[model samples]
Target: MESVITGLILLLVLLVFISEIYKIRFERKNESQDERGQFLIFKVKSLSYTILSAGIFIGFALVAILKVMKPEIFIYYMIIVYLFQSVASSIYLSIVRKI
Candidate 1:
């Protein structure tokens, strides 16, 4: 129950963030920097996918070999993966933009 509530809260926050990003992208505030912005978007996507793949693979291995039987563990693992993905993407974006 607690996990469900937490997930709902995180979902709401993520939705808000996505909407803000959408607005920023469409606002044309950086019309002259489309290439850089697109590069950042694609780079972050690629990195996030890589992290997600690795995370899922490790999670499956834990369940298959280590006998991780609790569903909550999987849920928490996914939440952690999402957080890591967000953090890593943010960091990568900031670094690339600085360059």
Candidate 2:
């Protein structure tokens, strides 16, 4: 029951984020730089975003695996894993921008 509720909340949050990104993209489409530059930047940014997303997926998998054996430590493990992943993502984005 708790997990279901959490899942629903997460879904709602993701939907909101997607909507906001789309709105921002539309708003900047004409005012922003040339189409080519926009495309290149967005592509590079998305690459970093994909890597970070993969890390999050791995974190969730680890959480599920540990849940079966050490339920008590699952939450702590998830938090630490996600925190590190977030840091890694920021680093990746910086590197991507340079490349």
Candidate 3:
């Protein structure tokens, strides 16, 4: 039962993630006429990607060095990286858009 519940939760989360991706893609396709906004979005995305990539690489190295082979650990690390990237991007966009 626990495993079933967990699977359902994971499914819901995946659906939500997919929906968010879809929404973002749709929104980007109809970008605003404001070039500055678009530029800021591009910058935020680039910065977030860089941070996420570096974090994942470091995580992989640490896991390898520590001999940690648990899939759950890697999943948790990825979740943290993703959350951090999202928050960082939002903060950067907010600050830059204010300028």
Top model by TM-score, which number? 1
Residue 38 alpha-carbon offset, candidate 2, angstroms: 7.1
For all candidates, the clash counts are 0, 0, 0
- Name the weakest run of 10 consecutive residues (lDDT summed) in model 1: 23-32
What's the lDDT for residue 75 in model 3? 82
Supply the TM-score for candidate 2. 0.39
The order of the candidates by TM-score, greatest first, is 1, 3, 2
TM-score of 3: 0.62
TM-score of each: 0.63, 0.39, 0.62
Prediction RMSDs, each to the true structure = 4.5, 8.2, 5.2
Q: Put the candidates in lDDT order, highest first.
A: 1, 3, 2
lDDT: which candidate is best?
A: 1
lDDT scores of the candidates, listed in order: 0.70, 0.55, 0.70
* Residue 50, model 3: Cα distance from true site in angstroms: 0.8
Q: lDDT tens digits, residues 16-68, model 1?
A: 47644643553355732598676777886798899989988888778777776
Count of backbone collisions within predicted model 3: 0
Better of 1 and 3 by lDDT: 1
lDDT measured at residue 81 in model 1 versus the true structure, 0 to 100: 77
